[model samples]
Target: MESSVFFENSEKKKKAIGIIHRVYLSQLKNSRKYLASTKTKSEIRGGGRKPWKQKGTGRARAGSIRSPLFVGGGVIFGPKPRLVYKKINKKERKLATISALFLKEKQLVLVNENEFLNFDQIETKLICQLLSKFELEEQKKILFILPKPNKKFWLSSRNLKNVEVTTVTCLNLKQLLKASHIILSKESFDLIKLTYGQQ
Candidate 1:
């Protein structure tokens, strides 16, 4: 009994194309931060003058140009030399992925097991056809979970503003839930399954 293969909902031995897992969104933690790893001295040099006499001006004495109070001064409590990436335990990440995949299993996430490494306009056509069959064309947000960087694939959906694309490795919880639909390529789906040996 190989776990990689699955039974279709309607046809026995027909083989379900996608994997399924029972998990929750909470299991997944945001592991990336937009403001991270700032260089202590990233070459933004402008902190030079003492600014007015120390004993003459009524204004409070000023210090380094890098002071956060001054305009163009170094940022205070701002993004700095810190790692923003949060780690979700391997099990939790897998669990979240599984939860996502389970949604796919129910057809909320469209699995194009037939789609692959190459790009094809006809592929888009076929995908549209599937959407049409499922009445998914009107979906406001459709996200594509790509396996990796593929120029052809990137171009396929660029024209559609509502269609968002991302790689499995770059999966974000907000983006995942924001979309009403998810398109999964066969290779990327397998990679996720392999990640947990859940298959």
Candidate 2:
């Protein structure tokens, strides 16, 4: 079906969230880049002159071989800097976000419109209050998307590793999938739509 439903042009029923779990999930999978096979050379530790002649020594061999003499010999195979970002179908990525939007409609997501002011303390109590009021206290993994985090907000939430925070522009494909609850500011959501959605 058509996906160009603008706020002004959307019909009553068409102004609804779309749910396509498999399409969403497949998109996420396609974006993952596996690096298990990367190889890297070890840094040089030491390599001295030959201990003895090639055949005069009683050892395995008498040579100026760096690999044999140095404890930090070059690794046979190790991880190296390789392309970590995999490709995802554009249609699939859009559809996945549509699915997330569907979840958002069902009280699964929280959008904070107000700007954070007092954040000197571990604003867990304030965030807890916000979530409790929405009956979302039980939801553990909450993802917060912002244009950029205010220092106070970052400090307040940094202690809680489960509460992930990221920029709207730098949203993590993996974290989005794992988060039970997705929280975005009004400005952040608008920014996302502006960047990836229709104009």
Candidate 3:
């Protein structure tokens, strides 16, 4: 496929920008864990009995020790675990992924499959050498897209905090947008072209 196909014109670029933003936000929302939960008065322990009589001597009227007014009491209107997923349509996601790729085209690097297959053992040094060869050693976040899963390659690159390896099938907008540089195998590049080029 021609590289020109990935280059969007002015009007299309505007639309792509919106799509990319929406998709990126949606990805973040869906992956977020709503674990910030607080206990309510009823759910608090040791709250079964009233702390004091409703008509107390000099203290304020107290019901349960779990009242929100207490220091160790349950929270009021506090956060609870709930879903915050934003559903993104398949076509919209595809367009956003394509748009991200287009925007980051300068950071994309293509390599032959043989280059990775040449690694005989699981060694971080090999991956480091490869990055040095591509002049991506200084990049903060590098993503490797492979046509298929390779245990050896994945293992070799796993130790690098800045490098991540993933198969094309698992590619998503979050990964693409987070990467400072994306290394694609020739076959993986072709696969992406075939899958997203038509759109």
Q: How accurate locally, in lDDT, is each candidate? A: 0.57, 0.57, 0.84
Better of 1 and 3 by lDDT: 3
Select the stronger candidate by TM-score from 1 and 3. 3
Q: How many residue pairs clash in each candidate?
A: 1, 0, 0
Worst 10 residues of 3 by lDDT: 1-10
> Which stretches in model 1 have alpha-carbon errors above 4 Å?
1-83, 103-112, 115-118, 121-130, 146-149, 167-170, 185-191
- Residue pairs in steric clash, candidate 3? none
**Tens-digit lDDT string for candidate 1 (1-199):** 2323543343432222121112223323244445563322224486566777788779888756656676666654556544444445665555555554554454445456555354655345544554566567745788778787666666666666777778878776566656777777667777767664552
Predictions: Cα RMSD each:
8.7, 7.5, 2.5
Ranking by TM-score: 3, 2, 1
Question: Number of the top candidate by TM-score?
Answer: 3
Give the Å shift of residue 140 in candidate 2. 1.6
Q: Write candidate 2's Cα lDDT for 1-199 as tens digits.
A: 1233432444532423332445445556666676565322225544466656777466777444445244444556565545554456675566455444433543345455664544556676666665676666544888777676666677667767577777766665566667878776667767776665642
- The sequence of per-residue lDDT tens digits that candidate 3 reaches over residues 1-199 is 3436655567777888899999888888899999899999889888778887778378898888889999889999999999887889988988888778878888899898888778678999999999999888645899999888889999998899989998877888888988999998778987886777546
lDDT of 2 at 195: 61
